[model samples]
Every structure is written in structure tokens, then in C-alpha cells.
Target: MPHFNSAHTQVFQNGELTLGLMTPFGDATHDLADMEDQFRLAAMADELGFKALWVRDVPLMVPQGSANTASNLDDPFIWLAGIAGVTKRIALGTAAAVLTLRNPIHLAKTALSMDRLSKGRFILGLGSGDRPAEFAAFNEDPETRAAVYREHWKLLRSALSSSDEQRSVLRSATGGFDLMSKPASDIPMIVVGTSRQSLQWIAEHADAWATYHREDARQQGRIGLWRLSLEQKGASLNKPFIQSIQLELSSDPDTATEPLELGLRTGRNGLNRYLAGLKTMGVSHVILNLTLKQRNAGEIIEEIGQYVIPRFPP
Candidate 1:
């Protein structure tokens, strides 16, 4: 069995739920010309006891819609490295790095470098990627993404593994070349979304699984299916389930939950209750993407740190 690193342990525990924040912090309309303030808020989140900080991967600016506007304009690895420099204890991660577009060897090397820089406080969340334009841009076929994902995933794992047996296998496959550096510690790979693969595949490979927020009934059913898949594979069933929410936090602490496209508009109390319910249903972590239109991101982080996080203590 692989040992859990600091990042994994900080954000995940069996039968408990922790909170995380997405990067590009502050108002959605805020200027991105300067990342200084963003780094400052990230440090504040670390000080305020947020468990992990997540960054997204968007290689291209193909606009999806009004609802899916891309805010993560920077490269995921470089962005997390910067975050690692500013924050002390808060774990850093890619919300979902597009696996099929990049070479597995390069991706693994960058991930290992980030892990070392963060002092074992890095989690790698990977996805197969869905955008057709992105696939075309990379000169990859969208139709073959599933096969590509499985192939690259194996290579990436081999590159990241410290075991001589695994490295030998990789060398044999790659015509005698070797990846020189190894991770400082076991870096947890959280498979984000379905990744165009089966639940069984994810259960067999991923250290954890992350998905976007869904309705309670659907989400619970998904978790049950994940557990069943693990059981079928005869693997440990304690792997965590992570979810992301696009939150528009209301100032009124007791305001009721109103559903948005991918998340909710709720006050601190409502958010706490919702997270408690998710925890009971087997979610291990919730990544909050603040969609604040009125309040400052710092204020909401403080409010959540004071009220919501205590109810689901990390």
C-alpha cells in the first residue's frame, strides 16, 4: 500500500469532511493582470485553516458559455508552484489537469517537482478533458481520448512510482530511458470526473475521486456506485469522494439554499448544513469556488472559517 502524504492527510480522512477553496480568489470581475492580491488571499486562507487550495487547467480560451467562463488562465503546475511559495500548510492541487493533451513524462516530472516544492503538500487531480477544440488544438482525436487516457495514465503512474519494479517496467516500455527524479513522498492522484473511463477503472487507479456538485439524490447514488466498484475490485473502500461547489455566499447566516447551475446560493448556516449532509453521504472534501458578486472574498473566507468549517472540522 502507498503511504498517504501530508497533502492527502490534510484534505482527506475516512468518515470526515474538510473544506477547500479554488484559486483566482476574490470577485469574479476582479482584474487578473496582477496575481499579488490573489496570493495574499491564498495565504490568508492558509492562516484561516482551509485544508487545500485548488487551481484549474485551461490551456485554451474556448468560451463555453456565460455559465462556464474560464477564470483559470494560467498553467496549473506553475500556478500551484507560486501558491506553494506563499502558503505554509494549506495543500495545493489541480482541480483537474487535462491528462490527454500533455505528455505523461513531462506531466509526471512537473507533478513531482510541485510535490517537492510544496513539501509533500501537492495533490494531482486529473481528467481526460472534454472540449473538442482543446483536443483539436493538441492534434489529438477526441474519439480516442479514452484509450489515450488509459495509456497516459499508466505511463504517468510508472513515472511517479518509486518502486524499482515499476521503473523497470517503464524503462522496458520506453526503450531504456528512465525518469530520474522521484517524488519526495507519495503524491495522491485524485481522478477528477469520469475522465471518460469506468468507475471500476477509477476505483482501481485513483487514490481519491473528485466531481462537480450534483443534487443530493444523484450524488449519493454516485457515491454508492463508487463503493460498489471498489468492493468488486477487492480494493480498500476508504478512498475519498471530493466535490466542488460554485458558491455565492449570502451575508445572512440563516438564508436558505437556492440552487444555481453547478452549485448553490446559500448563507453560512445553510452551507454548513449542506456540507454536513454531504459528509454523512460519504463526501470527504468540498472545494468552494466563491462566486461572490457583492461581498469580498476575504470576508466570506473568514465567515466560513469561523462558522462553517468548525462544524466539519478538518
Candidate 2:
């Protein structure tokens, strides 16, 4: 097993699909996660042997977009911090944090703080900003976002590594400085999407690759593409692939898969089969969003724990 961090070890099992829960545990009837209940759900997930608990960085809401726009109204760092206090064992991750919108120094400090709080369970997933509102509001040029993304990544990596011989300096958009409190363990970074960078760049930088769920054959193609990119770069094949899916689990164990918003409505049997397919395609982790479910979050989680989890056994 890789010894980088608890999160890395928990997520990658060589040939298995480790399950994770995305925050705001239940269905979102009000366009927001139930903040009151989220703490409880997070604790349950941790206690129930879930591999990870994922959160997203939605700094601002773009009101003019689709109906699926987020309204959770919580900071990712704050939420993860709270969950860290309440839970043990389950890895805490950012489904992704928008690196282009924040100061790299502050991001590094905050990420290290969270890693410390969680005892090295933090996975700092990064992405180039996608929303126009976010880019405009932050005065960041979208065309140069990819370059900025790479710069931020390089600075963070340097900040986190040991430089006992000499101090490490990081240059940001405005100024240059050294970040403090490097994490005790290497915080695993998983790049979400292409982030307007090449696969070769991703292979060179990211500890893992995280992408949206695709159909089986297409997903396999992506896995093949990732492996080929790594092979070309002489990179380690130990890098894991992560994918997220929205789930609406059914009561009937034999329920067939039906399309839903960015995921599927399926029973445990169907969910197991889908996960098995992903595992076979070299996917190491599956972060499941329960924000579109028809069943109770606790009930669904309990059922998954009882049946599906044993089959995968993260």
C-alpha cells in the first residue's frame, strides 16, 4: 500500500472500488443541503466504514445557470473542518477546490490545517475555474486560467515539500512568499477534469485523476487513455482514478438501472454491478452524491453498508 497519507491509502485498493459519500447527504428538495442533518450523516458515514466524505468548493452561486445550480451556502474548508472534528477514520476530501480563485499561500495554509485536523486524511482536489461568474468576480482571465492553474499547483507542491537545505519561495499573481505549516504527510492531489491542460501535464502533476462518471465503454477508453499517457511519461501506474456519480437508490434489490440526473436510480444489485464495472476499468474510488435520492439518507446509507459495501469492501 502507498504510504503517502491515510486518504490515499484508503481510496486506492489496487483492484477495488472504495465508496465515498458526497456532502449534503439527503435529497435536496430546497436546493440546499440540510445543514442541520449533515453533521449526523457525516458521522454515520465515518462510523459505517465509508472510505471518504467529499465536499465541493462552490464559492459563489451563478443564479442564471441551470436549475441544478448549488445553493448549499457553505465554505468547503469550514464544512470539512467541522466534519473532521466529529468523525474519525473516513477520509475527508474536496471533490474539488477551485485553485484559480484563491491565493495559493492561503490555500496551502488552509489545506495543511485541514490535513492536520483530520490527521492526514485530506485530499486536495483542484480544478481550473469553470463558471464565468467566478472568473469575472475574481478578475481572473479564463484564457490564462490554465497557466495560472499550473502555477498554483507548482507553488503548492513546493510549499508542501521538505526544503531543509534552503527555503522555498512561491510566486503568485500579486507577490512572492513562503507558506508555513507544511503538512506532516503528503496531501494527495487529484486533478478534476482536464482543467484545460493536456493529459501529459495531468500525468506529470496529479497524484490521481478525477473525472465525471461516463458509460462503461467510454470510461474504459478514458482509463486506457490515462494509462497510455502515464506510460508515455514513464509515470507510476499506482496513480488511481476517481469518478463521481449522483445516486437514487431503490428499495427493491433487483431494480433495474434507470437514468437520473448525472447518475442513476438503481437497487443495490444494480449499484454493485455498476461499481464492479468501474473497478474493472481501473477506477479506484467512487464518490457518490446522495442529493438526488428518493429514499431517506440514513436508510440508504445503512442499506449500502449492509449489502453493497461488503461486496466492494473499501
Candidate 3:
């Protein structure tokens, strides 16, 4: 495998935890209308020393439930390209792009193009996809998504490989079409969720692993499992672990934490301590989704940038 790209190294240092922001930051219903403001805040985050900016891939507005009602989301590649134009250094990534639903050739081309456009600051996060409606729309059977995921993953990896041996193998298998463009460096592939695979599979194939937020003890246990998987696979134990959280920052800097569904409502101090604990437990990065209902997103970002990020420098 190729070495870590610039973005991967910047965001996933072993024994350290870095912070990133989730893009399209506002109430889901209003995200499309808030694009200009979103870019402005994205630029602000870049300046404020955040490590990366992540965007989601929601191909259709499939309402999964009351909590997961689809929002108008921009295509992850296009959105990240726009963000790349606005920011200089902060890494740009997909929280995950659905691998089973996209053609591997196109996906590899787009990822390489984005990596070039971002000047080597792109990370490719992949998922097997979870929504049955999305699978049906793509004329795929969700029942076989796991097998599809593995197949697509192999094809995508072969397409993206810089190794001459790998490239030759890919060409022989595909009967000889070239990818045409090359990445600035290796593009990091982080497996988001299980993608219907075992921990051992992820540990063997992924550059890193990304998962959702959980309680501290549960998260620690998950990290333990990840470590054990890496050990069992003879992979690097330093391979990073990532998690995302929905944050509602309180006005008072010292306010105590209150748990939300997959995140927390907390002040700067509480947030700092929580992130510190994550670092100790082996989390390499945390993506913050600012669920701002009562404060300006910029204000909360600025607060986190000033008070929280400084303590956990990338």
C-alpha cells in the first residue's frame, strides 16, 4: 500500500486527536439556502486551525425515520471541490460516499480528480450504504450489499493504486484502459462503519476506521476491539480510529455536559475534557456536527477554535 497522503497524516497522528467540522452546517431544512454562509464558515474553520472539513453523501431524500429525514445535500465531491477553492490547508473529505451504489471506475476517477484539485488534501471515506430505498433506486439488492462492497472496494483500490505492479494487475484484469490522471499522493481510504464487513476486514484493508459517537466506556470497548483486530490482522496498531458527534455549544464556557442522541450539549471546558478523554482512549480524530439551535454557527465554531482546538493541536 502507498504511504499516507498529506491530509491523512495531518488529520490522524497517532497518540493525538484532531478536530474537524461537518459541512452544510445549519438546520437540515435550511442547508441549501445557507450555502454562501456555509462557505464563509468553512473558510473560517480553515483559518482557525481545524484539521479537516467533512461532507456527507445523501444521494436521495429517502426518509428513514423522523430523526433521519433527508435534507437537501450537495454532492460530496462537488461540495468538497468548492471547499477546496475556499480553503488552503484544511483537509476535505466525505463522511462517507456509498461504495455499493457508485460505479468503481467513476468513483476512482472522481477521487483522483478531487485529490489533484485539492492539491493532495483529499481523503476518501467509503461506506456500503445503509438505506434500502437507495439500493432499490440504484437497482441493487441490499441483501447482497456486503458482497458488492467487497468487490467494489477491490476494484476501487486497484484503480487508485500508484504501484506499478498493482497497476499492471488492474490493466490485465480490466483488458487495458488507463486512469489518465494520478493523485498528488496516495489518497487515504477510511472505512466508515462496518460497511457490512468484520473488524478484521476493515483492519486489513482500511487506512483508518471511522465510527459514530457512543458513551465513553462503550467507545473504549470499541477501540479495544479495533486494536485487537489490527493485531490479529498483523496491520499497524497505529492505524487511526475516528468518530463523529453532534455538538450544541452552550454560551457559558464552564457549563456541564448534557447528552444528546449521538452527541452532547456542552460548554468549551466540558467539550475539551471529553475530547481529551477520547484521545486517551485512542481516537485519532473527531468530526463535530454543530447542531446550533440557539447560537450562531460561527460563534460556536469560533469558541471551539479559540478555547477547544488549542488544547488539542493537530
Candidate 4:
């Protein structure tokens, strides 16, 4: 198999945890996000040496559910493509692309095009999707999604093969044509959550793991579980583990951490200490979601770049 491209290797280095910024890049207090501001935030993150920038794949805006609640208002691929053009080196990724909703051939081709356009700097984070309304809208069976997920995953893997021989091994689903534009090298694929599959299945197939962030103690246990699962198959888990969290920066340098939705509210000092603990617990990358912050998004990014990021330098 071909190795992952330079951006993947750089962001997921062994024995070190790097930071990434999730898009919409603003406080959650609002309903709308500006496109120019989003682009500017991505550029700043790249300039500040953040390892990656993540965008969510939300195909439909659910009526009153969480989808309609937040400011994630763009197609992840189109948005990431815009960011890729302006940024020089920051890795671009779909926090996850919902594999169940998209055709595998389409997913594979679009991903390859993005990787080529970005010069080998795309990470394909994938998931089975959690929204029931979406499944209904697409006329897919939510109950049988696990089977669909597995089948489509196999198709995508076959379609995106870096070797021409491997590409030819599987005939197109229609048995009528050959897929084109294999990635320049393997695009790193991070399986998100279980995607309704077993741990062994994920460990065997994924290049990395991107799961939800949790308290340090619980997260360590989760990583331990993954390691044990891989070990049971007589294999070592050499791949990185990644997580995404919400962040709220307080002005006081010594402010204590308080509980929030997916993350915590804390000062830069507290944030640094917290991230250091996560790194020590075996997390390889932390994707920061700036949704619930009270400070100006730009200022918070700058402060993190100046203070917190130096402690966990990429």
C-alpha cells in the first residue's frame, strides 16, 4: 500500500498531539456566519501553524433539530476547497463525510479531486451519519445503515486505490467503466465513531481514528480500548487518534475550567494544562470548535496561537 501524503504525516505524528480549528469559526450565540470571515479564520490558522482545519458535512438543514440550530451553513467540500486555495499548508478535512448518504464513486472522485487541488493535503474523515431525518430524506434505510455503510466503504476503498492494479481489481458497480484519478498517494482516512461497525473492523481499515472528545480519564480508557481491540487481531495500532471539542476562552489567565457542552470554558493557562493532559493521555490531535466562545473569534485564535499553541507546538 502507498503511504499517506505529507500533510497527513505531518499532522498525525507519533508521540505528539497537534491542534486544528473547526469551521464556522465564531461564537455559538449567533445564527449566521460570514463567508469572508470563515475564509480569513482558515488563513490565520494556517499562518499560525495549526495542523489542520476541519469542516462538517451536513447535507440537509433539519427543521428544528441541531442542524438548524447552529451556524454550519455551507457544504464542507466547497467550503474546504475555498480554504485550501487561500491557505498554504494547513491540512483540510471533513470532520466527517456521511458515507451512507453519498454514492461511493462520487465520494471517491470528489475526494481525489480535492486532494489533487490541495496538493495532497486532504484528510477524509468518514461516518455512517446520525440524523434520522437525513436517512428518510435520502430514501435510505436507517435500520440497515450499517450494512449499507460497510458496502459503500468497500466500494470507496476500491475506487480510491493508489495503485492502478488495485483500482482495476474491482470492476465498477455498474460493470461498465473504470474509475479514474487515483490520489497522488493514499489520502489518510480517519473513521469517525463506530460508524455502526466493530472496533476490529475500524482498526483493520482506518488510517486513523477521530472520535468525540471526553474528559481526560475517560478518553485514555477509550484509547486503551482501541489498542486492546487491535492487539486482539495480532496487530499493533500505529495509527493516530483524534478528537474534536468546543472551547471558550476566559480573559483571566488563571480562570478555572467549568463544564460546557462538548468542551470547557477556561483561560489560556488552564487550556494549555488541559491539552497537555490530553496529549499525555494519548490523543494525537485536538480539533477546537469555536462555537461557544464569548471572546472575539479572531482574538481567541490569536491568543491560542500566541500562548496555548506554543505549549503544544505543531
Candidate 5:
């Protein structure tokens, strides 16, 4: 059965650091994740105490190039539902759910329903859709994501807030329409990347910020630039900062220490060696997904939980 507690709810509230795993395979274009493993691995991640398992919302990965996809390819939500039934505590999240592709009504229902199943453990992150091909499939112009995303984001918030009339815009036209099962709390919405909107808007509206993985030189630059934005916007809350890192944790966490796709292919030890540096560099959480990784994903997870976690236990 699904379990809920203050610890799960507090993943967003303070200086908490969390980890996430992307799907278990790699992509063709841009090398983003395309295929993923069967649900069994994800359930294992849950038992191991991973904060979340992120799935990509890639609709079309360059079309005709489907066969080249690395692993089992299917709709992410299907996988989420399957994983939900098996795991008790882990969160099912997208590195971001591209709001521009999905209909907001359906998405609201899906997220809230998942929260109910997980007993209020859903945390949603979104961004202006990045893949142009995906937006095109929905008959949407890639350039129009900023406007559409802002509207959808606002509408979802209102619909999810109250079970009262007038505030309900999700299902029926009447205001008092309530979503079948609203989430226990304001389901967190973290914006992944900048959408050309004001930093103030993100600060005022976003529950947290999700950013990309950067090497040392670029990492400092990112912290500087984003901190400037936060300072300029006069942001007050201790909004958490989460980034994704692709790693290859082998039997020896020391042997793997070179850059791979968007991340390094370092052994578990090398990965941990750099984490303290990252924490000091102002990253609140790091979701290290060995997805599309070079080594065994399950072995990596165990190694991380048993050996690496003791050093910098989240």
C-alpha cells in the first residue's frame, strides 16, 4: 500500500536534498532519454529510498527514428501507474511534464489522482516545452509555449486549490465543480528552465526551481546568474534548487570519472567525491539518474544506498 508522512511532504519545505532517477534508457536525438526499462527497476528504486523517478514527456523523438530507441519505449504515464501499484514511498515525476503537450484538464486529474494513490507524494515540475517536434504534434507552435504555459499553469493552480464552486474550472463550466480527488496539499509545481518570463514571476509563483547539470566552471556561472535573478526579484522563501546528473556507478565508484551524456561516467566513489563540492556550490538537491548509463543501474542503486549514502545521506 502507499505510504505518506511528514518526511515525504517536507521534500520541498527546507534544506532537504533529494535524488531522482530518469528512465532506464537513452535517446536518439539530443541524446535525451527515449526508451526506459520495465517497471521492476523503478519499484526497486522506490524501496531504495530514491526521492523520485523522472520520466520524460517526449512525444516524438525525431519521428522515423523510432527503432533506434535504446530500451522499452512507452507512454510515461503508463509506466507511472504501473510503478505506483508496486512502490509505496517513491515519487513518480517527470524531469518535467511538458504542459504544452498535454491537455491541462487531463493532467490535473492524473496528477491529483496519483497524489491520492501515493497519499499526497506528488511533486510536479514543468517547463515551456523544449522539443519543437513535440509541440508540432499537438498542432502547437513551439514559440507559443511561454504564453500557453503561463495560462495553463495558472488554471491548474486554481482548479487544484479548492473543492468549492467558482474555483473549479477543470471539469465543468459551473464554478463549484470539484476535481474528483484533489491532492492533500497544493501539489508542488517547480519550473525547470527559464521561460523568458520575469524572474519575479517565477519567484512569486514557482514552488521551486529545476535546473540543468553543469560542470564546475559553468556550475559557478549558473549559481551566480540564478542568484542574481533571485536577489533582483527579492525572493523570500527558501525555494529548493534541484538539478539532474547522469552517472555510471560501477562496482567501484572510483573508476568512473569522465563526462558522458549531460553527466559524467564516474564510479560511485568519484560521484560522491564531487557531491560535497556541488552542495557547497548551492545546489539543494541532486537527482542522479543512471538512466542510459554505462553500468548496471540496479547495482549502482544498491552501491549508492549502501556505500555512498552513508557519506552524504539525504
Candidate 6:
């Protein structure tokens, strides 16, 4: 809300269409042992002309939750670094990192190192943790997650941006300043969820705002809130309104209105219609998750690259 370019304007000036993969790590259908599948798929995404690759900071997944079977995975930072050496054209970003569960200083070190390794291609996504089980195992409380989350995000930002004189007070540093290289700039940080964070807070401190599974009809009002918050703060941002959606483009083109957690269970027609509505609602980018597909990730990728992206917002 303070001062940043909206992701919408930034995206339009650059390229707007983006694709997110929930890394097919534990799929029993294929050889799940391929640890590098994420990297390989990321590279393939870039080669196939995708804009960015989204990774996540998932440590523990709720087995019965909507994400129950989806998360047979690890920390996203590891995956980010693994693919950094290979990916060139596509920017790397996170869906959201559970900051409340990590040591602030350590997390900062990882963020800086990943950005440096990627040559300023990293976008840090952070969120308040909602998983009580994860909080319990780590000796954290769900109620205090917001506080911890803010504290860690601020600490990480300060560490990444501080000079030697400013950082001298921390008792310890990862790798003693030289262990992990620093990124070229203050790597952009994005906020995940509403998080009880005010518009003034977001406009003043955040680089972008991320929402999940918003209905098509509601895009305008949602993005308008973000924009109004930015305007009210008297801040200028090169920020954009970014949202993630789930889609199932079946073999049939007609839309199917079915029940879904954060997205629609629709075919190509509904998918396009929804996306078109988003474009009109002033959304700059949408990270599509094809986890609802009846087919494999490779097949899903092909379907999108050939059919969906070609018609993205101008």
C-alpha cells in the first residue's frame, strides 16, 4: 500500500499469463522417486513458454484436508535452488511460506541465497500459518501465528536489506555472511491471504497481494479493495493483483459447474469464461493449478499451453 507497482500494470508491460505447479512429487502413477521432477518440469514449463513457476513452503500437509493427497513434498526453497541453475527465462516464486514455523534469521538467509543464485529472479511469498498440527509440533500456537508471521517477515526483510553495520547486532548469521550470497536487490516480497493485515499495511509494506480460489464474479470487488488500499496509503507500487485458481479442462470444451474447494470444476468453456471475467475485473495474473485434471501433469501442461495461454489477457 505504501509504494509499489501493481502486478497488473507490471504484468501487462511484461507478460501476464503464468502457470503454477503443485509439484507432482508423490503421484503413484509415475516413478515418484524422481526427486528432480520439479526442476525438470519447471524447465519444461519455461521451454514451453510459460511465464513463471510457483513453488511453496509446505512442511506438513493435512491428510484429510483438500490438500490431503496433494502434498507428498518438501520445503519449496530446496526446489527453487535445484531448478535455479537450469531455468533462465521463467521467474521463480512461492505460493506462500509458513514463516511462523521457521527461524527468522535462517529463513532470511535462504531467501537471500535463492535470489542471489537466481540472479534477482526470486519472489518471496509469505503467509500466516493456519495448521494447528504443524504449530503444535513446532511448539507454536495457531492464535499467535499472525504475530510470528509478521515478526519473521519483517526480520527477514531487514536482514536481506541491511548493511554490515545494521546486521552486526544479530547473534548469529547463516554461513557468516559469505556462506550464502546476497541477492542483487531487496528481493520482492508478496503477502499471502487477508491475514487481518490492513490496506495501509499492505500498500506501505507489501510488494503484492495474493488471494486464493476467488469466484469469477467476485474478482472486481476483491481487486478493487487492494487498489483502494494502495491509493489510500498515498503510496506508489509497481505491484499487481495476483490470484491462484484451480481448473479442470476436460476433453469436452463446455463448462461444468461442480463443487471445488477454491476453484471451479469446469471444462474449457467455463474456464475461458471465468478467465475472461477476471481480465475485465482488472486482474493482472492468475496462477492456474490443474490438479483437478483427470490426466497426468504432462497432459495438463500440454492442454493449457496449447489451448488456454494463447488467449490470455492483453
Top model number, TM-score = 3
Q: List model 4 lDDT by residue over 119-216, tens digit each.
A: 98998899998889899989988998889888888877766667766565347574857656566677887788889999888888878888887877
lDDT of 1 by residue, 1-314 (tens): 87657998899977899999988775433345257878888998999889999988878876575666655377778888888999999999998999989888888879888888889898989999878999998899989989999998888777677666666656866798876666655778889999989999999999998999999999999999999999998889898989999899999998899999899999888898899899999999999999868898889998998888778765
Q: What is the per-residue lDDT of model 5 for residues 62-163, given as tens digits with 9 covering 90 to 100?
A: 443334442234566665666777777777666677787777878877877766666666667777766566666788887777888888887776555533
Each prediction's TM-score against the native?
0.95, 0.92, 0.97, 0.93, 0.83, 0.82
The clash count of every prediction, one per candidate, is 0, 0, 0, 1, 11, 19
Candidates, ranked, lDDT: 3, 1, 4, 2, 5, 6
Off by over 4 Å in 6: 1-19, 25-33, 64-70, 162-182, 255-259
lDDT of 6 by residue, 1-314 (tens): 12211222223233344444544322523333365665676777767666667766657655545445535555589877777787886667777887778898777778777777776667777887766778888888888876767767666765655355434433244444543444335566788886657767877777778888765557677777787888888765446677887665576777576757777776666777777777667665677766544666666676666777778733
> lDDT (CA) for every model shown?
0.86, 0.81, 0.88, 0.82, 0.66, 0.65
- In candidate 1, where is summed lDDT lowest over 10 consecutive residues? 26-35
Q: Model 5 off-target regions past 4 Å?
A: 1-10, 25-37, 63-72, 162-176, 291-294
Cα lDDT tens digits, model 2, 258-286, are: 87757888989999999988888789999
- Model 2 alpha-carbon miss at residue 102, Å: 0.7
Clashes of 1: 0
Q: Model 2 scores what on Cα lDDT?
A: 0.81
Residue 111, candidate 1: C-alpha displacement in angstroms:
0.5
Query: Which residue pairs show backbone clashes in model 1?
Result: none
Least well predicted 10-residue stretch by lDDT in candidate 3: 26-35
For model 2, where is the 10-residue window of minimal lDDT? Answer: 165-174
